[model samples]
Target: ENIYLNGAILGMRKREINRKFDEIVDFSGCARYIDTPVKRYSSGMTVRLGFAVAAFLEPEILVVDEVLAVGDAEFQKKAIGKMQDVSRNEGRTVLFVSHNMAAVRKLCNKGILLENGQLFASGEVSDILSLYQTRSIEKIKSKKIIENEKLGNAEFRVLSIDAISPEGSVLSIESGVKIQLEFENNIENKNIAISIFIVTLEDLILFEAPIIFSSDNNSQKGKYLIEWDIQPFLLNSGTYKINLLVGESQKYIVYKKDDILTFEIENALFDQGLNLNRLPGVMRPKVDFKISSL
Candidate 1:
């Protein structure tokens, strides 16, 4: 790795390449394989060795792609920690890219987002993540069915789930929207519990509602439509997935589909024509606030 980094890829090694290689081998925990040929190394070992070389060389700037993800979880953790230590103690700049939002949030302070090779958003890490999350969900709006499946011996099946606006467009979700679900119940004269969950794309459940179908227990076995209203929408601007579950008394699972629907909530609230898109927290509510002297 050092030979290549020192222009040895062109068949000329730097005078101190051996010293550099030894330092990296000790740091990357590859000292035991110093005598092994590079071709015999595993993919994970190669990645670790490469990263160790790049990180320990004391370069003014380190450019890292998603290669760290090739290593195992423990190695990834250690690698991130090493980068953090480098930044804090050595005062070097590390440019990293990864689809793992949690890791990005933990490792980075500033973030730059790109789309189609064009600059999209550049700001604090938290804001950039929110923007990325929102764009990801917007892309899903163009699709009809994100997922379709049957569960529990096909006793029930969700046909389609859609998040629609009153204007009949699925591109964006405004305040006070509705999610429409169409499903088929194969069994007649049986009560079922239906539940809808509003969850972040990361699988964190933010809101959930349960509906008892006892009144419709005697309904015939056939297809049905249900509309769930999210009035006074308090969700902050970000990407979120929807989950639909149906079962007997909410205990016995009949059918449960997770991440079946995804939607993007726009930052409609603006100030003086400026977008207030960076509102903190997972939810934004229009509530009155008052402070009085006691």
Candidate 2:
């Protein structure tokens, strides 16, 4: 009833409200509680109902500000789909405000980045998202150790992790990056295996490198330094974080740390002809392409 009343107040005719009532209820997933009072609804339920009412009313413009953050994942997806339908098929305007870069990138064509109540940048969504990610990476303080807790019987202790370019300068897409890891081994007899995970800012694990122990020298009880080199043109231009894990041959994990180091890979200055703008995927590998006049 409140949904219908709100629809009426928003200039929706009775016939129009009746036509879209089922859809609004179904979309919000609040059919069971349709008869219940709005005061008894949970925060998420309220948000869902409100959004459903506003969206189904078919207004000229819709303003949503972080409302989808309250609902569950399924509801959020449906809401985003509805918004897309409204904007594309119905030719309506949706003024969405959210800090979710991934969602913004998916829904919006243009982006406006605001900093300290002032307009920072407004342009293509991808470019704005890249700039936003780079700015976020810049704010992360580079720390030596993220957590002080000893992991797994104190057998292995991570000392430091560093991400540096081959020339020991700022990282770029064209630079071959090196990951240096220093750790202290407490056990002598047991073999230790180290794995490094390259994760995006969105918490997606792109790929992992596992350094397995094959010799007795590597299992010695002492401080050790290991370096992993990532060739140029392997990773795309984005902010990435490192997750470290030290264990013994898939048996058990001794030490595990997330976000031990955060680094940004800037776009290469040189042009690659047709591939000018940043590629879509997480990786931009250098693959051999043989073009023939066939």
Candidate 3:
């Protein structure tokens, strides 16, 4: 089966592919799909079939990506169990990549943290997670505003930016929070457009807010405070950064900053054994699920 998948790369014949396919089928307990077309396979079946084929190859080292995320819960459990067995009994090395923190904690003994496409740190899984959490909290709590006069043009410059809590206290990732951006416009009566981005630790953008200046209004030159109210925010528990851009229009940029601000959301406990922090993905909006026996 391994040869069947790698036929194009290894330059194998049809007979060789079928021979290995039968062996993998017997080993993987996938006899039912012995003659099924690979293109017709569903996402979960494809992932399982790929893993099964790779496992049967008996290689000294295995590399895996997020394919395990495609399968159903039961299939995911089976795949993880098989990996554990392979690593423990067969003494084969497995490199698993995933954004599911809980699964990583359960499956791997060691972990590595990557920042900006570079190796940041490597240690025990718990220590790595602790390090990530601590650094995120410290970075966000210590910053009030990022003064970057160089990024601003003659018309406008950023003075400070900060996140505020709903109860007029320190910023906390609870329910209601607002982000305040302070800027000074030296030239008055000019329309300024502001673009804001909320990005994840992995540099993935989660949300964007744009402010378009109105031509109908005229204002004097002074400092301006722009607020972004995030009520009923659905972001998952993690560290995030904010990117800001100010310009005359969306096309022309006057000031731009990347990863200017940082914040962390603590784990939130919900009913029915649900932890907001433990959930996978960038955001977890409130969802309604219905279940009943058919």
Candidate 4:
């Protein structure tokens, strides 16, 4: 029995995992292929078709690259949902790669990180994402310079975005803490817009604000200044980050600052336990307990 188990092409595995389902399915000989291959399609079309077909094919193992970005916004959501369905219902494995850290955290329970053509880390997706964000932020800070050239095929360099906090202040309680974002830009062409974001340490974007200095169908030029006051900065005791953005409003992207800047939030102590709720689990949303019976 052991010899047969170890030394066989079966090898306790099969190439077509959906074979059982296929046998039970009523094909009715509807499967056929046209030999004339489609040699051309816009990147968006290709993604729509590819993701749709792969969703239906239901392979044992699925691998998706960054090609998901090729589709439009609506299609991207569909593709993600499809991939998730395949993994959960079909009990299959999926390998996905993306620069969108938020999406990675949402879709994957496991992660593989690569840095400089080498394996940096591989484990729980949250841990890997945290490490990746840390590394990216460190590199961004080291440069001490942020450059932006995606403003309508022209250069718009952002010199700095300075984050500020007073001593012993809960961010949520303090309604209006002055946060400064300093920039150095020629701003010679107002063909595009500039945007900025305030992200939490966990990469949650708390706020995103944009500044458009051009109007009346013409280009404006010069250095720029942008400042804002935080309102009800509802972040629990933890570190937060600053993320900068620049591009068209609909299809905007990362600008000079390729990573996040860190700032710590201080919270006053209560009767609750440490780091989280005394009861259990990983979160501590404000709540009150009441005893009741039905």
Candidate 5:
């Protein structure tokens, strides 16, 4: 089975760094920030302390949430390097969740993507980040009606994407908007891959869906419809776009990639207290959490 699930790894290597581990952590440049109040430390310092503690504990599988984003630049690098050390030299596993694909690509040998809290894709870092980069940018753009476009080495003449009720509407201001995407997939092969992405105006991807493929395209011809039955389009109040593509995994030529179809989500659309402004990292899929009182 694919690893990196939340509860799979039980043994965590913890460092009793109270005295001896503190010396090691101090050498790691953590002395400058340890014992400081959480509010007083810089973002990077927090990460450094967190890394120091996690390393001292020596967890078999290191699980890092979005806390990486809170660290400073130098500390981010340090934290990543420390995590790499734990995973490699110690032969322990690491579960990292971050929107920074560059970091993910640089540090992790593997990748796991969570959408609406559900595990959507997990595999080698390159492929998983590729899928994430592709789809996460598609959700925020406005769907457009276009024709005759080329991606990579192929040219495609397309139509438009549509929305079905109870279907999530791509590039819309509302959540829970159901939608479908129809395009003229003018490609050469029967087996084709497609992925969508939703991105912010700053070109940051909000999230992405798994690589959806067509194994049943009978006629590889002029115009076609790609139905996207998206029901729960969970997003915060932000401007977004939907990017579409038709390509094969990793190496296949992209017929349409990063076509920005746009949307603007209003703040009032959500109910009171619903807008916690705390969307978990980038991947917003539902996560399963069980709590035990300490």
Candidate 6:
């Protein structure tokens, strides 16, 4: 009934509402509760239903604000597809706002950034998202200390994590990068293993480098620095985040911190004509290929 009422308020005819009623209910996955009062619905259910109605109403312009954040993964995927259909197939416009950069990159061709209730920037989606990521990375202090109790038992204190080019210069796709991690061990006579995860901004773990202590070697109470090197041409041009994990014998975690550091690798100048930054996948290794005449 509320869906019908909203359709009426949106200037939709009663016949049109009836025509799309079943589709709206199906899309929302609220068929079982279609007859129930909306006041009894959960927050997710409410948002799903509301989005379904609004999206299926055939409005010339749709304004969606963080609606995907409330829906489950499946619902979010469906909602994105529906919005794309409305925009592409029906020749409508969708103005979407969200802090989820991955979703924004997937859904929008253009972007408008706001800061402190004022327009900060507006341009191509990729450029706007890159600027947003750079700003966020800039806000993170060079040295981050683990102060949250819920992250770990405080068995190990992370002093700092840094990623930079091998020569201590800016990182580029053609440059080998080094990750330097400094931490303090608060306990003695325990076996400690450290794992560093290189992840994408979308929270995808590309790979992990583990430093395992030998069985005979027990960790001592002291500060330690570990450096891991990534070869050049191994990673594509993009923003990458770091996750640090300290564990006992690589089985039990003693401390863990996500997004402890972030870095960007600019595209190599040699590939200026290739646009390698837009290439798919997390890695761009230099592979050897053999070609022969058959």
Per-residue accuracy of model 3 over 104-207 as CA lDDT, tens digit each: 76788888888889999999987987787676656654543334445466777777777666677544334555789888777565666787899876556878
Q: Please tell me which model should have the higher lDDT, number 5 or number 6.
A: 6
Candidate 3: deviation at residue 130, Å? Answer: 4.3
Candidate 1 Cα misplacement greater than 4 A, ranges = 1-23, 31-34, 145-157, 162-181, 185-199, 202-239, 243-259, 263-294
Pairwise lDDT winner, candidates 1 and 2: 2
- For candidate 4, report its TM-score: 0.57
lDDT of each: 0.73, 0.84, 0.70, 0.55, 0.57, 0.84
Residues 226-293 of candidate 6 have per-residue lDDT tens digits of 89999998998888898988888766778877888788888763765665445777788878899999
lDDT of 1 by residue, 77-134 (tens): 7888888988878898989887877778888999999899899989999899888887
Candidate closer to the true structure by lDDT (higher is better), 2 or 3: 2
For every candidate, C-alpha RMSD to the true structure in Å: 7.4, 5.0, 8.8, 8.7, 16.7, 3.8
Residue 94, model 1, lDDT:
84
The number of clashing residue pairs in model 4 is 1
Best by TM-score: 6
lDDT of 2 by residue, 1-294 (tens): 898799888988999999999989999999999999999999999999999999989899998889778989999999999999999999999988988767888899988899999999999988888888777666554333324444234788777678999888778888978999878888677767889999988777988998875456657778888999998888998779999888876788777877778988888747857567767888887878898997
Q: Where in model 4 is the C-alpha error above 4 Å?
A: 1-37, 145-161, 166-177, 181-196, 199-227, 235-294
lDDT of 6 at 145: 37
After superposition, the stretches of candidate 2 with alpha carbons farther than 4 Å from their true spots are 5-14, 29-50, 67-77, 88-91, 109-131, 142-157, 165-176, 186-194, 210-221, 245-257, 266-275
lDDT of 5 at 127: 86
lDDT of 5 by residue, 1-294 (tens): 101111123333232333445444563475655555567866666555655665656676778876567756666676777788888899998888777766777788878888988999888887886677566545433223332242234345445553333523333334444435555555555566666777764467656665545546464655666655443445554445666666665576556556445544444444576645434343344346999999
Better of 2 and 3 by TM-score: 2
Estimate TM-scores for all models.
0.55, 0.69, 0.56, 0.57, 0.42, 0.81
Candidates sorted on TM-score, descending: 6, 2, 4, 3, 1, 5
* Model 4 lDDT, residue 10, Cα: 32
